[model samples]
Target: MIDKIKRIVEPVVQDFNAELVGVTLKGAKRNYILIVFVDRIGGVTIEDCTKISRQLSKEQELDDLLGNNYRLEVSSPGMDRPLKTPQDFKRNVGRFLEIEFEDKAGLHKLK
Candidate 1:
């Protein structure tokens, strides 16, 4: 589901010279929430989010992707962003980090 949404949104984001960091789908059928996390080299502004939301919303509606009522949210990854990929880790090098592993090894802090 998310992959499909990413495929639909990534190109549009790139067109604006931004990165589509992540996409999350949550909530029940009629109350579905689609959260899109976007970022760029410097940072993402409210205007950037609004523009992406408006364009992506129209595209999604036209394609009938959701086919139901869903709230779409577009925003930037905050300070405590997740390092989901190696690129993210590399980008944050030299910055303090607090990480938690899935194996429950306990939280680890790195700098």
Candidate 2:
């Protein structure tokens, strides 16, 4: 479902020059919540989120993709969001970071 959402949402997001960071769907059949995370080089703004939301809601395919009873949210992943991919790390270069991982020794961290 997430893959489908990404496939459907990616182009619409890029039309505004934003990257779709992630998507999550939750809740029962009647109250599904779809959260989309968007980002770009200069960061995203409320207007960006607003535009994305409007565009996404205007997509007929998305309506059929998720059925008729769901709410969509568009927003940034927020400050202190964990960096997951090589590209994510690369994009955040020179910014302070906190990394924590677990191993046989229990846990380790790098700042």
Error in Å for residue 80 of model 2: 2.7
Model 2, span 1-111: residue lDDT tens = 789889999999999999989999999777889999998876889999999999999988878977888999999888778888886766677767788899998999988
Model 2 clash tally? 0
The global C-alpha lDDT for each of the candidates, from Candidate 1 onward, is 0.81, 0.89
Give the number of the best model, judged by lDDT: 2
| Candidate 2: residue 102 lDDT (0-100) | 100
List TM-score per model, in order. 0.75, 0.83
Clashing residue pair totals per candidate (backbone < 3 A): 0, 0
Model 2: residues with Cα > 4 Å off, grouped in runs: 101-111
Which stretches of model 1 miss by more than 4 angstroms? Answer: 61-63, 89-111
- Report residue 27 deviation for candidate 2 (angstroms): 0.8
Task: Looking at model 1, report the run of 10 residues with the lowest lDDT sum.
Answer: 60-69
